[model samples]
Target: MSLVDLIARADERGLAASGLACLDRCVPLLGGDDEVLRPLWSSLADGGADGDAWGERLAKARAELDCADPSADTVPGLGPDPASGSGSGAETETEAETEAAVSDEDRAAALARRMLATAPGDPCASALRAWADACSAAALQIHRLLDVAADGDGPLVAAERRRQVAVLELLAGRGAGGLRPALEVSTEGRRVLRAVVSRRARGRS
Candidate 1:
């Protein structure tokens, strides 16, 4: 099923088959190198008391699936070349490997899981959901601001000018939330748009 469906099912059934399906997709979707996958996997490893009963078997499954520790250097196929037992093989790390090595999203997922585990009620879910939402909003806001700056002071100019300072603040990393960094990075994009338009406007005037 889709990710949203899987999450909903898991909520209803406490890690039901659908949830497992969602988890199964995580490796491919996040890619094997995603650091965020680790915490999700960890949260699973922490498992409900019931899954914990399966113990080592569950752990083995997680490892085999490549969701156990995305940051692990033992990636399949990327390992030492068999013939290169000669030790002369190029040891370049692929983008996938690099991503897996540092999946920052992992920590956020883990924190959400821990909070959810303690109180499976609306309060816990809402709090974590808010964090995710905030991150998404910050990212989107950055996009809008950049678009306005890039396209010039057109229809968006008025609205952008109003929110311009707020957008700048977000890019400066003054905001606090799960998605703050992403918002911050988006700032550079806004900067590009602002500079281009502002320069053009000045020349015209």
Candidate 2:
């Protein structure tokens, strides 16, 4: 099915299931660390940096995942390399103000721009970028469905979409070679997501 059709079906179903499935499919297709790393690393080189709260939140999330599964590695958005050199996880109070939260729309736009820029360069790069754009657009739509679920709509649909995104990410070949950390970050999200989908599929209420 088309991404939009999958999204619509997910929305009609529920949150915790459908949305998660979409992400499984989407992230691999459009999301990952190394791609973001280049831009983020460049941005840092450009003198922009993240804050303490941001780092701490990431650290904490990583720690929690680590405790649950020692084998997992950090995802791109949450993974910060100390070797890149800025400082400890601590952010200056002012830095906190400057570091904006990563929004779904912002990510999607960035992907679209990257896709456009990369498409003319090389065949593989163009393909990857195009896939990324598609995934990002799909993610934004899924995020909207999640917003609806948060407002008391279809939880199962939300879950399914998320899973689909993640799965698509894997299928797109972006999720390979990062088994440990990917598994860690994706475990809980995947678990909850699957449960929701399975329940819904079984016609549970």
Single out the weakest 10-residue window by summed lDDT for candidate 2. Answer: 11-20
Question: Clashing pairs in model 1?
Answer: 33-100, 35-103, 36-106
Q: What are the root-mean-square deviations of the candidates from the true structure over C-alphas?
A: 17.9, 18.8
Off by over 4 Å in 1: 1-14, 27-53, 70-205
Q: Kindly list the per-residue Cα lDDT of model 2 for residues 13-85, writing each as its tens digit.
A: 1221222222342232232322322232232223222323322332332233222232222222222223224
Question: How does model 2 fare in lDDT?
Answer: 0.35
Name the weakest run of 10 consecutive residues (lDDT summed) in model 1. Answer: 112-121
